[model samples]
Target: MTPDDQPFRPISVFTDIAIEARDIVRGDAHQEIPGVRVEEHQARGVRVTEVEIFEESAERLMGKPRGHYITLDVPTFKERDPELRQRLTGMLTDQLKTVIPQDPQKSILVVGLGNWNATPDALGPRVVDRILVTRHLNQIVPEDLRDRMRAVAAVAPGVLGTTGIETLDMIRGIVDQTRPDVVVAIDALAARNLDRLLGSVQIADTGIHPGSGVGNRRQGLTETSLGVPVIAIGVCTVVQSISIAQEAVQLLVEELAEDVTLYKILREMTPAEQRGLVEEVLGSRFQDLMVTPKEIDVLIDDMADVLAEALNRALQPQLDRQEWT
Candidate 1:
């Protein structure tokens, strides 16, 4: 088919790594706009996908920013296998260490962004409760022990609905007061694919948009905005209803193309056209619905444990190793 035969497409609204990775996996060599680089790897059965949008142009195209985005896919994290859990934790700590500043003495602030009352949004708050907070302990600990341990502090700023305060504003105020060298923000994210929900963790140095996962985007917390390096860690806890319906229609079109005349007609249409048609039919019904797993409460607890363990180890590796050994 000629280039002109392609249908006009709407930009994707999903804020997950897999959507961007799809273009590369489909063998679309030119799909990557200039200034973007992607790399993939495997660590102990987990798939690690990394996408770097290096310039404003590429950032605009990806709808992210000029920083590194890393996604770790471990579909069986909820299974709670000891060995697998340990491996995943190790992988998470390794990735986090890469983005975090290397200064051993630098103070680090951990910001958990979410509403605790909602299970799907409680991942962050739960994680904060599990982190190894040493900032307060540093003052009373012996000099040698205190010197060896990094200063770490954590906070879970409740959502605007409860506090009537913008989450970013709270963080900014804390950042100004604490003067932390780096800020690590954790929150629940929304994925475009159901397979990604509850099975993936994303770490980025580009900062985070509170509530972006469920499409209620708020002001972003970033290095430029906060005057400190921000490292964001998130787990996909929900998927949009439109994405589910769109994928179902695509599957149906593929399955029936060989025999059904109508399916054959759809098969001849450009991908954009197919998606457009699907949206026209399903958009109104599915637009605002966000779907999560039936076992989200259990899954959120499991994820919070995993993420908290990883962050604890990453932020206090020296102390963590000493304790474990």
Candidate 2:
């Protein structure tokens, strides 16, 4: 049996976070999915969920790779409260360390994978702007002065549209030359729920596919392609327009239920049927559209700063050890 009760919506399902996909899969598929493990905990007031898929069957069932996915859900992240900000950053730092190889000497190449020109898709570039780059610091700064920082490099490779070069190709070239032991990629992701946008971060060992969130497919940056371990950090920056419409329609139906005929019809339809009806009404033009929040301009910067701080803490082994102790 498939993870989901209904026939999976292929394109739409890909846009959801791995945890959301797991939630949908948990209904009636089985009491549990073999080779898949899920654990949840609270850290610094944030909900952290870790999903581990140990076998090919589990990987195929989840539509994610055979590795680990850690998600941090803190919807208030968009509000820009400084105290809350530090807490979430600390949580993200701890989760990031789990996926990264436990080697103090591992040099890291942080690849920011998104279009810098578009604010909604610019999480990668924005984080790179604030991240502490220390790969070149060894020659000039003394070890003690820099707190024994690891060699860390960062790059924001523009999308194929602007640079006319495949993102993977550019990163592969960098990896070949820099020879970093691991690559951490950051990108904007799309979620089915509006609340998750600008509020959730999903980190995975499966790397990432540029433009996949918006239904535009590109070659994925995975371990096999990059010849190194890859840890992808994704922040939900947009939500599918169709999902917004779906919620609106549901609310309208529920509010107008005194009229019964339409309410009964909707109640009789399956989720797939409801989504299909919404799609038909929305037509093909709006199918691929994704949306961001009204205050994205300010929130994006705040999010970038938080992610940069977390990356800094996670990438530096000396700092990571100090804090964990």
Q: What is the C-alpha lDDT of each candidate?
A: 0.81, 0.81
Best by lDDT: 2
Question: For residue 177, what is the lDDT in candidate 2?
Answer: 97
> Residue 322: error of model 1 in Å?
6.4
TM-score, candidate 2, is 0.89
RMSD (CA, Å), candidate 2 to true, equals 3.4
Task: Please state the error at residue 284 of candidate 1 in Å.
Answer: 1.9
Which residue pairs of candidate 2 clash?
none
How far residue 169's Cα lies from its native spot in candidate 1, in Å, is 1.0
Candidate 2: lDDT of 239?
A: 91
lDDT of 1 at 233: 92
Quality of model 2 by C-alpha lDDT: 0.81
